[model samples]
Target: MSAIPQERRLVTAVPGPKSQELQSRRTASVAGGVGSVLPVFAAKADGGIVEDVDGNRFIDFGSGIAVTTVGASAEAVVRRASAQLADFTHTCFMVTPYEGYVAVAEALAELTPGDHAKKSALFNSGAEAVENAVKIARSYTKRQAVVVFDHGYHGRTNLTMALTSKNMPYKHGFGPFAPEVYRVPVAYGYRWPTGPDNCGPEAAEQAIDHIAKQIGAENVAAIIIEPVLGEGGFIEPAKGFLPAIAQYAKDNGIVFVADEIQSGFCRTGQWFACEDEGIVPDLITTAKGIAGGLPLSAVTGRAEIMDAAHGGGLGGTYGGNPVACAGALGAIETMKELDLNARAKRIEAVMKPRLAAMQEKFEAIGDVRGRGAMLAVELVKDRTTKEPDPQATAKVAKACHEAGLLVLTTGTYSNVVRFLPPLVIGEDLLNDGLDVLEEAFAAL
Candidate 1:
């Protein structure tokens, strides 16, 4: 067998001349005010390095929005997906059924936390999985209200928009969101309502009580949350908060749904962030890295609750496509064999210190938070006031991108820089990315 590629060779400046030209073309080709984080147009990728059209190679820390934990263009994943494509591309699970789909479901059932009999339904995106989870919860609990947390990001779908906490980009003009969705406060300690470092489980309990009193516990079908909030600055809820919420949901018959779409697949040092608290959610939604880079998602949960929906209620036209399922099976196998969970911890080991160093030097870095490979740094104008520094954050991110490191920014206030490097990234390349970040901070 050929050896694994291990080099990050750059032959041109990032977003080289060709990439800039292509970006110009993209502006007219794409619609809906589509935005791009990095300007480089990928021509090829292996391991942790991505090569653009102009042959400029750079370290990837965003991992395609956290979808390539195994690394971009993994050998096993590509081999399996290509071989499956040769056999047959589509045999939609709902229409013709396929073994690959069943195989993927079985893997998810075993991987997701919970020894209780669990079932999984596949979909094309995280939003679809989340939307379906809501449907299943309502069907099982016979309730109408759905509760969400502040700074949480579910998806861009109408229902998910209603569930998402951000308003400007996600909910802007997208009005008349699905009804019965309500928002609650998350345990964001750094920007705590009372004061810095003042939020914890008690605040979460208060939010829960408010929801119960205003919306009525009996009417609530589910309460969805990210064990480690992703787009919301990689916030990890205060200790005990997740467990308390899980218990409350159990007592009230409100399905506890963990939105692990960005936090799953060992991104948070555990296969699922919910596992960190030892809390088994009634429903768990996952996507992104599950199928390597393939567009595949799943909603796994208690078998009884999952089965509550009718036969035709849980399927989509392209849900669980055979090709994507094959890719997922291969990706899962690779993750187990390579021990990606350990890899995530390794990434955290390297990043936490480097970021802490940056925080020590940069007064704008108000907070550095996250569990593992999924991490973020929140920018603020002043430590005392904690006013978001969106402009400065954007400047640093742009500089990093131009200097050969692809990064992503996310937050309710657009002042957070999230790092989701592929767990398979090499030590040297990872360090180089961090060095670029340091340079960006200096530039800012």
Candidate 2:
């Protein structure tokens, strides 16, 4: 059915001659700050395979950072997007409203957690969605301070950088970040000072106390968090942690915003990870996987809160582009038709046990965490110390790349090897990628 074969086939070494040539050109023209996990330049991608410029096809474990849940070139996505491209590319939603934009908003309302009347505003990226969510929350509450947790990565923008806890590449040189952003401890189960059982209640109590004491609860606008922390080692908050936090926010009138950018759209075995704990956020930000591969993000929330912003207060020139909206419609269609949420669960069923086995064999594997297709392995120097082994993590990722399996590494400590295969990926390809990972760990 697909043009590209769903198998791993390496015609040349990773980053072959053609890719090398492109890399040279990229270096000369592109900004140095723009980094890439893999050096190979992709020419064609379908299903779970990314065929590079040199004709080497690598099994895609990283779904372009979880943006292509249905696959790179899904049938519905291509068909709808192609049809929309021929019809009309852009008119700008703010200038001239489109049916596709409204359709996407309606879909999000039905899909995202909560039965209450919901509304949505589209943007071009996760960062923009998050920024706008913050704007809406502040407007609704008439508050200034916004609370975030440690290891939470909202985005790369100035305001998000301040909200983010990590300081390395994200916030290193980007100083003088926006004010009124406060950081609190997250219930990272692996690194929790107390045992995992107590992590949920203890961390929530501490976080709430900090907000109340350090920053008055009345002054706080939003308590935003990732249902499952992405770019922070795929950390899922301890059980009961999210519920407690959400309840606190509800009681205090603080807007609970779920940043479901990476974990939304069946990537975590559900439509959104927040559904796992039954936490109904006041405002939820979505992107990355919303529009197949096109750039589209949205802030979906209770209608009352969303309407807090004045007329023409929220919008961008390129937000909700017609083509991207079409892709989103197609992607959502494919998800339902194919039952991608079940597929994500199946992926987890296949990956978790294997990763657990690897953990038993490899001492470097500190922990294996994450949900459904969004899984990761945290590498450490020693089991007792749990000192992050970023060097070993790098080696494992390199080995996977060399073996024709595309994987990604993420974490605040840079010691997490994350796997985000397309939900449409075949079981054979998934097993083969895991085989490559096992071999990589064995070699290490």
Global CA lDDT computed for model 2: 0.95
Best by lDDT: 2
The TM-score obtained by model 1 is 0.97
- What is the lDDT of every predicted structure here? 0.88, 0.95
Candidate 2 residue lDDT tens string, 213-296 = 999999999999999999888999999999999998999999999999999999999999999989889999999999999999
lDDT by residue (tens digit), candidate 1, 1-444: 213345555676776889889988888787847777776798877678777899777788889999988887777888899999999999767788888988888888889888999999999999999999999999999998999998999999999999999898889998999999988887888877675345676667788888878898889999999999888778889877888888889989999999999999988889999999898999999999899999999999999999999989889889998888888888888888889999999999999999999999999999998988998999999998999999999999998877888899999889999999988888888898999899999988
Q: Lowest-scoring 10 consecutive residues by lDDT in candidate 2?
A: 192-201
Model 1 is weakest, by summed lDDT over 10 consecutive residues, at 1-10
lDDT of 2 at 251: 92
